[model samples]
Target: MTDALLPNILQFIGQIDPFDKIPKNALRTLATQVQITYLGKGEVIDLCTAEQEKSLYIVRTGSMEQRKVDGVLRAKLGPDDMFGFSVLGKDASSDKGYRAIAIEDSLVYIIPQTALQTLFSAHPDCAEHFASQAQVRLKSALDVVWSNKEKGLFIRTVGEVASGRVAVVTADQTIQAVAHEMRMVQRSSCAVIYDNDTIVGLITDRDMTKRVIAHGVAIDRPISDVMTHSPLTIKPDDLVLHAASVMMQFNIRNLPVVEDNKVVGLLTTTHLVQNHRVQAIFLIEKIKYAGSIKSLASFTPERQAIFEALVDGRVAPEVIGKVMTMIMDAYTRRLIQIAIDKLGPPPCNFSWIVAGSHARNEVHMLSDQDSAIVLSDSATDNDRIYFNHLAMIVTNGLASCDYPLCPGKYMAATPKWCQPVRVWKEYYKKWVSNPEYERLLNISVFLEIRTIYGNSEYETTLRDALHSNIRNNREFLSTLVNDAITTNPPLGIFNNLVLEKSGENKKTLNVKKYAINLIIDLARIYGLAVECDLSATDERFKAANSQNALSDDAFKNITGAYQFILSLRFSHQLEALKQGQKPDNNINPDSFGSFERKHLKDAFRIVADLQEAAKVRFGSR
Candidate 1:
């Protein structure tokens, strides 16, 4: 390899496994021995031939297809896919006649047997990796990709990538002082204005131009006069997506990150654009103003692309769910707004409520409609007619835009679900007072709700009332826990993924039904039992754990399982999209490489332990 490309190659190989396990100096030496080659279409290399058998090939670009002696295709390999599995064959003189041919113009790197042997002797793990059977080799390779991404991306929290030590100024400081500070720093374009250590405002250079310079306002005036008061803020622990959303929502270029009543740092558009490749942020803006059902429907491909980006970025499932939820939030609100425009304003104050995955903000690619209308107490028959028509329009529009209609008729388009706040409370009253099996199903769905549109007070009053009832009503919570445990996580005694052996989903795990729903049920039970308002699964577990409603280990096991199951589901959907298929919940265990197979077993074990813990906690309640 040329020295110009050697550093890049060495850095890449250093991250991938077998190479990663080897020392840097050894990798540098191996980098020198690498021979890069280009091939045109139909260029064949006989891997089984004695002359080529001793060389290992890695496809750096384009595709190479391997075939058996009879010309039946064995596999198609692309960038980063390793081949020449028999490079260290015991019988070097034998020819097996299986050959790999470049199906397109290709670029590949070859490592000769001599250099490989030297490196292998120094690092036995590298040798063992290459010598392993195909199954084992497949696993190690995947593990390499995953481990490198883990160490590289670290997509957990804003704190992971945020800059430290934000600049702060007092609210009473003069605009002149703020402008001077902005100029002095030169590099940083913004500053947070604080009062008693609480983030009161933020001032960016743009603000200085639009508010002060343009208006020719006296620069000697207090910074509060020109600063953006009560600016939208984020936490250091918040996801970078949150910061991006705040910036997008408020149409501001910077946000003051507050943690524990202190400004921790400033997050700028520059940071987000430089660091994250998330497209969902851009997608949200488009949905907000999309007026027609046809325009909204056109984003189906971009919606899929959003999922693909999150999956490829190795973002955590919880964050992925929230980002997707944020996108749907845009869709839901815009639909409601469009509906309102067409149907005229509502007859009374109301809140558009979204429940289930949408409510919990744990949405995946297949998130369907789960919504209701909570009208004001003064609503009448005319109001009912107005809302019923409105729900039909909005729900239908959502369906057209890839949000399928709710299967159980749970959507607000149904007249019964479109009701006044008082009537809604009555429904909760009856459901809680008598938790019959059917009513329990509704309770499970309704318990987690997010008010996407209209008067926030309506949902707040209803949720407060619900929480109040759940606080002392042990019977209601008992029934909830009982319902939560009705379907235990589908795991066999041997800790294998227990899939349906018969029926349409035969030989596949219904990840949504068994793994995802089970976690949701537990979170609902624990959250309601503890009277915690949070509906997100991870937050519910955290709240319960902090309150000692769950043991430390129980909390860890359950939340860990939740994350893993959701991650698997996202990956599955992404895989489906790549294959030009519709994404769904069913996953075949065989589809997973051994890396996922091992984690799947461990995740299921955690699920089992979680079920046991939930059972014990509610056995007497």
Candidate 2:
């Protein structure tokens, strides 16, 4: 190793964790074994064929792409990222051949497996840091793949696996008779069928107790009287999770598995629940128990587990939002608590306000954390001083937890964000009454706020003031509508998705910015105009369903568009996570299959239609 390279390596290590406590001689030993190499763009620095000599390579500049045996490019790695630790002593001919190719001219430092092990033995923190970063990237990409697989619409047919023996009853059967039969079969539910096996209805334990027994309906009457007619049925070939969704949505315990329009088998909530990957539930529980920052940081693995389950669970969009929000809120609150502890107790009570996805309780895997602070006005000078310090500590603590600081300086630590409740109300009133560009943008972010920690009364007051101002302001509503419509979705000439055109992200489509947020903005405006208290975009749309503010056609169009965009974003983020890269919304459209491209086009069309409708509604105002 060159003398200059040693200092650079030491400096990099210092940035991660200072090596001041290590013996000088041991540091020298580390410096001696390190090797540096320069790679030009498109160079293959490490191939599966070089599996005999395992080494960890850290990027100093530029990026690398990892690929599988089928030549499908998997992930892109950037500066300060490490890879190749998993290839040690593995046979080259094994199925797990991974290749790394440079994306641009770059410098990489290599550490042999033996040296890394030795270094870890002495400086465990360094090794843990590297491992944590690698795990985050890998888990993120895997999450994408898992989510896509779960959301894919290909239905599985029941005829393919039907055993031909299924519990069934005729509509003429009495509830008591069916209940007795169900108990005899050791099943909680059964399907009602006609003479030729056509599924006419279904009944479950809840149906028996709630509809028949509770109503004092004669149990001797036909089961059809108590059974749900035309119950939601799924084809056997449909995905198992699709049936699970039907169960969850209708609060039913059973589904009739149909094939060729005939009942072939029965599916129960227990089947769905049992098949669910328990790891996800475990992860959610662990996150709930994470009472400290250090404990929360250990949840990366748990987060990965949840990501994987979400993909595999194929949960409904609403449920997905709930699950993601739980983890995101827990992590954010834990980080804030850490910061508070670091800064000592606050001199006065304050509310930690989460904005954006976190605030709406609809956070996805790739979403960034956005938050603020609303201090109680009863604070003394000492309280202000203590809170300001606490805010910075909280912000930095979140950054360490993989939530990078907001590039727009909207974070809680910013002086503009950390304010008393009175200041926040004034900010809201000014934005609502006078719709300036910057003010409107700020208002959009603020609309999603939720109280994460501390006294929530301050948040309640601020929300009430915002709603009160918007309720009577027709002109302000129209201006907001115009602003919402201005996003225009991502539609291009001939109704194509307009992909990004600059820098390393060229040819990628920003699903979150161009597609999802467009729907969110429109929903926000509609909700505000109608005085809907819902915060989640989907919930807002549902709340506006009855109002003439949005026509039925427009509501359906926007809802479908939002779901399609969210599914795409979820898939992209999961893929990025699995590939050991940062989960993001920049997805290359060309990478999608023909069916996905078709759906994406349809989603964009829906957005465009909604935008046109908004323009028409507001232009006259």
Candidate 3:
């Protein structure tokens, strides 16, 4: 290759996979040994039988697919995706052969076996990424993409940043003694109350102030009298981001860090504020106290900034979704309070529950309002009026904050969705017992539900009813599998990508519909088949794995596929937001370079494989 083109090739390789792990000077040397060649759309490279020198074939641009000798599709390739790893090993045999076909006009980079072996000798660790197994390489690529030198503040684990000097006191100790212990520790905003070698309660400074001084209670009384019983605690390994959410959700300032049911340290608001690199915690605080919808709406810029920061931080997609969901919950709760102030206290007890992405805790920048209100059975017609009005204000208020309304009118503002507990139970029964295709589409969104506000028992009651009905309904899961398999990943003949034939999104792929949703549907189907009530996609798969419905490898591959595809969608959205354009799921095919295209193809293939598995698993019924 010419010197000028060599630099370009090095730049491309430097940003991708196992190559990214190589040292700079070594990468340039390796780049020098690469020979660039072009192949026409219908050309084929004989990987085993050809008399040419053995080499690693990396696609620099365009696309290709590998097929077994019997013509079964081995894998689809895009830019930065490499083949010929098998031949690089000393034990490779011609009997285990596959051929690469240029499904699209392609530019291929050929690295002679001698050069790669030499490079591997110098950078021994890099060899693992070139394992013949596609799973290993894909995992290596993920590790490279996720690892960072300067980690974000919230991404750190609680144990890494929390103070180890905790004040542990017996429940029988007097409040005066506990305060003395707190003073001695020098790290105490809260003290863990232990009894018989078990954590039984917790007491903070606020407890001393309110329960002792303000109430004129005797300080000589046992701390257990005022301590919070069975206090909520976070594990040492959980992210500080999650700790922050827990604090915000319950409106507490102190959280004891526990592991194996033993107190290790404490995470407080002080620690969170001290390490703040982003405004997520602050924005959530603002959302909580903001009295006016206009004030809440004005924080949209700050909200977007948090999203951008989380994406750039390379935090796990599930963690990012949780952080985003907490913020949304804050907004929703505040709006409900504002409505209550204007319309008077609620006429009856109710629970404001969310569905779909919101319920699954997988929300993103594009997530809309998928919620409903479950009223007390005692609610009257007058009560419905009050709630409908309340729902309108909250939904519109969410819109002003840039969370658009659900296009299908799934929000609580719709009377059909805002119903009493009995009606909600009936809806689940009819949908599960006699699912029609039209109702199947609607029920899929509500299959995962969570209560964010009001009487949580209402949610528990509804969930139990739904799960019971689902377990008794034999044909329900198969129906869901049938619907889910109807929309396959956009993989076509010769493993070429299928794109939108025409329209505004022409030549674009809907990653959500074609890839992410397919995995989610499979998780839900498998999750429910075993009576697993968890809402999150990853958790559902874990439940399936634990139940022996999915093998360990299948579970990991499918979940990894989900995370990779979701991250790509998030990156695509971030790009649009930076360009001052609206973000949607339809991603332009041309926008993906070889790196994204290759991994995306891998992710798509994983989803398609699981879809077939689901068909055999459930469709046989």
Candidate 4:
């Protein structure tokens, strides 16, 4: 390339990832070695040639398509998109008849293997982008988003933040001895009681005041007498967000960090309070004590604030989903309690369950209510009336707290969803046996159910019945697989542009309908085919992989794609919220910069490939 054109080449690649990650001086040198070439619309390049030297190709001016030996489409590439990655790394695998064909008269840039190696030598961080494994490349893409992040509470493990000032005592130790040890050793507020080598119990300062002093118990008694037996613990490797969840769920102020069955350190409310960023982690505690619906509704702003902090902290998308879901759970459970107080206790045993996104623990800013109730079989018609009133109160209260009512009435407040346990089992039996496309909309929402309050066994019984019915009906999965693949990802997103210029969805893309939900549907099919009971999308994919339902490479690529797309959706929603707009799933292509647009194409391609594979696998069964 002439030196005059080098600056233009530098500018084009500079805005794209991995190249953007390269140092400016090194990138200028890389640009100098680029070879510009052109291809006619029908021309093809043999990517797996035995005689040709290996090289990387980047489209500069027009579009192209890659294909395998049998002419199956591999990917669609547009300007700034890359190919020839299969031949870049040390463990580069054979393309096995894979080739690139220009769909338009194209201008392309070729980087010789030697020139690429020279760049990698100076900037090793950029080399992972060319890695043969899809997971490595996907991870490198995600890393670019957090490249500016300084390691903070969201990224640090529990071990990194926990205090090592835990007071360890034997189960046989006297209560007075344990208290003295706590005071003498850093004034630790909690003690872990061990029986020989095993952890037996945990005691807190409150236990001393209430169980000892308040009860007039002798101080010489064994500490086990007052300690909380089989207290919940967290692993050192766990994220602090997880520990925060455990503490909020159980209403504990202190938590022991245990690894290998040995207490190593302690995490307490004081430790969490030091980081203002974690204030949202403890917001659930406040939700627990809110006096009424109006007070609970006031926490909506704080919920948005928590989401902003989590995203700004660069927390993983799945973890962010979980944190948001826990807050929703807190709101639901608290609202139920408030309803009970107003309407009096239920006349019979029942379970208030959540379905769809809530059950999946995948709740986000745009998520609304998808819930139901399971009543005991012995309930009378009068009992039904009472439960119906309670459901109505909780559902409307959730809407007051910023969670919108389900547009389809798929809530506990809906008469059809509030049923006796046996009736729920009957619903599952009918859905699995028929698997009709018309009933799919309703069936899909309740496919994953979880109990949030009341009798837990009712939820378990429903799940067992559902799974049993699915296992016996082979054609059910085939029908689901067919439905899942009907909406292919927008692979032409890059070539034709990322948005529709006309129609009801003009100037925007419905990412939830076209991309995210497609992956969720596929995961559900795979999960059900293998009898996997997990509700979360990522976990269901993982469970499917373990059971050999999906190959290792397929599993990693699909899950990574799902995570990337979800993160983008969350980011889009956050930006809308910041701009004082109502959050929704419609994303404008014009909003995406070069960096996001490029990776989104890659993620879309991955989902498309997996969908094709699913059609072949389950369509035959």
Candidate 5:
């Protein structure tokens, strides 16, 4: 390559990463040694089972289609996208490897692996970005066959396992005596009131200690005076895991089991810990025991087993979510290591953020991947190169693992989505301060971000800033409310079922998009305004109640709406996964039983009513 053409060649590679960090001299040398290849449309670039090499290929122009061994087109890659870096990694597994072929006449830049490694070593930021991207990709690949084997595990109703022994006290009983009965029975908690075959209140040891002993209040006071009235209770026939969530969310040790408005039994946290048989005991043990990723990977097979256990255990949706989050987190970290081994290293300090359902820690079997990168503000031009490369690696890796790329271009690899921490903060400020239609949409999407890997403190700082900005901005809150209200559940003109325009059940509507998103948006706005730290929509609703953000009636209506939507989504996904179909948000109401349909309709009505109230509150503004 001549000096005159050297700058152009360097510029093209610089547009990618780590290469951007190479000095002018080294880049010129690299340009001289690199090869530029051209291919006509329909030409094969690399076939399946081709000899692997330690080099990277960047498309200078045109596009290519990646295919599987069965000849199915899997992905399309355009200019600026690169491939073949995985050859640099230590992993020898290639059974599920992809083959590349030109879709259109294309020009490509190929760089030797040694040169790329030299660049990465000289510019550590580039290496980091490469590593991060690779890790994300590996994680995605692993998720594909990670196994949901535990899907059929035993799920029994609370009524089936109830001890049939009740520990109860009258609402008029003294707190002192109630505490005595609790301790004498070796129980951490007890139901406070059993009246007319109804459960009116609950009092636990913590409540007694905090409300009476700590406050220096007389223990002789009526239990009703210190009891938690109208406490969050579940029906006896409900899933035990649901009860577990109520306990975890409330930080309580026990929950009252209500049957036909009567207190039947008390469910303790200890009981669940003792009885729940987790299949992937090894995975859980590894996660709890391992202090590093190296150790965590040693139990990778166990991780798969754990996933199977979760599928089979019939664990409550909430617990399943928690477990999945833990596994995914570990998986992502390991992939990052693999990417780093392949790409070399990062150009600068950065954090990989998880968004959407995963960020909220509510991922289901069919969930897609949503993530972004937050680089340090001090990152130089060289840093941008590495970060961009890292993003691509992670996004593509995730695609291989069964998480389809976010159709909305919300993946970490996109420049618009990847930014320095300071830039992200500025972006948040702009969205919150302006609160325009587009900005509001961006805020709604980004606010759901949760730190899944790297520098978690950065995520915390960003979240705190968001809370501070939104809490003080009444106008922004109002705008959010207005935006949230716009997507009201679609109720038919005759107040009957609103059907879909197409699909197997053409007459059925998607409850997730219309109903669930409505509640999620409403809860998000309320939570933001109140500076609630909880991430999940359901958890946010509960937090909103504690903060008195909604009236008791409104709270009940929304809670019921949330539960109905959740149940519907769970069932739909369960059936879809069972049939080997891709789980999706689209749901057909007609497929549901009459009672289920009625509950869904009622939920939508509640959502519609709340939306109207929201409009009245903010639409006028």
Candidate 6:
């Protein structure tokens, strides 16, 4: 290959990923290995197997259509597009059930399998590109900044992924006219109904079917009559994960995105769940219909399967945490409903709440139940008795569904926790004012509360009280920071791993106590110090960094360390489960590879450095 030809190949393939990330010298070398071919229009290449045609095909000019043996169009390739990954899956246990053929007279570049394998081994990031090569890039496929495959394909913002065309109508428009406009326009699944540019409601195909087609509502009725009012909305820049979360959380398919107070895009669940088989959204819907705790328990194997899939795909730990939290949230909500069915409606308005990891939305397979109840001020002694019974049944139900009761008895079943809104406020006020041992413990665990079911306003009352109390008391924040700084990362005399000297997990690291929780504590301290109500560890850290409390290096180091430790801890627990052992935070240092050990130490050092920084900043309380 001449230098001029190599530069041409570099210019062509540079538009793609992994190749774009490769160093210029290495990329030039890779470009030299390419072999070019040409075909006439409507010509079919009998590219049967990897052994027969062991090369990747990249279209240089003209278009081509890849089809299955049975005649289904798999993908249409044009300039810069690549094909022939089906051949690479030769050892995939089965055929990919597809092949490529030419639709137009074209010039294609071919990279041999042997050369690609050598390059992939040389550059690990290139391997991801090879892995995703088999997936058909249909339309508007993007190469985004996402590094994990667990989210699958891309993790671009809603604005980037959402269809650019916004389908909308006024609330006063007739359903007939709305339906006509939908069919005449872009054939949308749903349309956002607005009132003078403010999004007021939404009408979906499901609503049209159930509310109109089934019930036979007049076609000329105002859209406001059947439209869902005050619909859930997402910001244009929000992550696609958040869009999936809101869709699954509310059991809706269409999500409208607002930007600058204008409805800009409507993203469907179809956009999110196209490639995934077992999404949190899908699982949550199943949990909702589960008739009993036993039925919900039956889905435990499915949960394990989902966890294994995410782990095997090498997704970020924060991604897994959010996914698992959705499952925990589903279980909590279902158990509450089961309790409600048996006990009938409560005597007064109340809120069912969850705290700690669940509230933070950073849960994992090993997280336990930390919860409470906030009742309306109108509740009487008899009402309290009813709520206690309800809480007991719900907690017991949750246990049956694999969510264990709180070890510290912080559950709603306890009378001290199942209190009226006014009493809960008083509790927070006293805890903040005192900052004693027990108070500190309780406040740390319960400070980040989230509403799960029932009247959310009840929880809002307690939340406001807690926020108010923290604002007036900076000493308590310092005290919490002081307490937080004491739980140092486990590094021994020689800077080796400090393993447990005794316990069931002897000679193992308690990752939760020593590292994960240490980060959590620091995050909580930072949150309180900045008066940031965010609960997720990464969010809290970022919030602190935004407030100029955390140095740039410290922010990056601590966040990276925290996520890596979480990933390690999750991997350990998952391995334990697969091996028929009970999973815990205890990870044996002997199991660590040289690579893991090195990174683990670096992560610990960051934790220690951050702790010292916090202690110095906050000082002794």
Model 3 TM-score on a 0 to 1 scale: 0.84
Better candidate by lDDT, 1 or 2: 1
Each model's total of backbone clashes:
0, 22, 1, 0, 30, 0
* TM-score, every prediction: 0.71, 0.55, 0.84, 0.88, 0.52, 0.71
Question: For this target, which candidate reaches the highest TM-score against the unseen true structure?
Answer: 4
Question: Candidate 6 on 1-621: residue-level lDDT in tens?
Answer: 666687778887775644666777777778889988898888765555434666677778877766666664454555555666556744443545456666678898888888888887778666645542222111001122224444662234788777655568999999998888777785887888889968898888778999999999999999999999999888887767667767776778888888887878888877776634446556777898899989998888787777776765666677777778878888888888888899988888889989999999887778889999888889999999998998898888878778888989999999999998888889999999998999889988888988989887876677778778888986777788888877777643111236777767778778899888899998888877776767888888898899998876577777877777777787788798889878888877767643354345456656876777787787755
Model 1: which residue pairs collide? none
**Stretches > 4 Å off in candidate 3:** 1-74, 77-81, 84-118, 133-135, 167-189, 194-200, 213-220, 245-251, 259-262, 313-315, 492-496, 619-621
Off by over 4 Å in 2: 1-277, 284-292, 340-344, 492-497
* Colliding pairs, model 6: none
The CA lDDT of each predicted structure is: 0.76, 0.67, 0.84, 0.84, 0.65, 0.76
Residue 220 of candidate 3: its Cα lDDT? 94
- The sequence of per-residue lDDT tens digits that candidate 2 reaches over residues 369-422 is 578889887877677778778878777766666666777778788888888888
Given candidate 3, what's the lDDT at residue 103? 85
- RMSD, one per candidate, in order: 14.1, 19.3, 4.6, 3.5, 25.6, 17.7
- What is candidate 3's local distance difference test score? 0.84
Q: Least lDDT summed over 10 consecutive residues: which range in candidate 3?
A: 490-499
Task: Name the lDDT value of residue 384 in candidate 6.
Answer: 93
Better of 2 and 6 by TM-score: 6
lDDT score, residue 77, model 1?
A: 63
- The sequence of per-residue lDDT tens digits that candidate 4 reaches over residues 352-374 is 99988899988898899999999
Candidate 1 has an lDDT of 0.76
Write candidate 5's Cα lDDT for 125-193 as tens digits: 445434322333322222222333444323455665555555677777788887777777636456547
Q: Estimate the TM-score for candidate 2.
A: 0.55
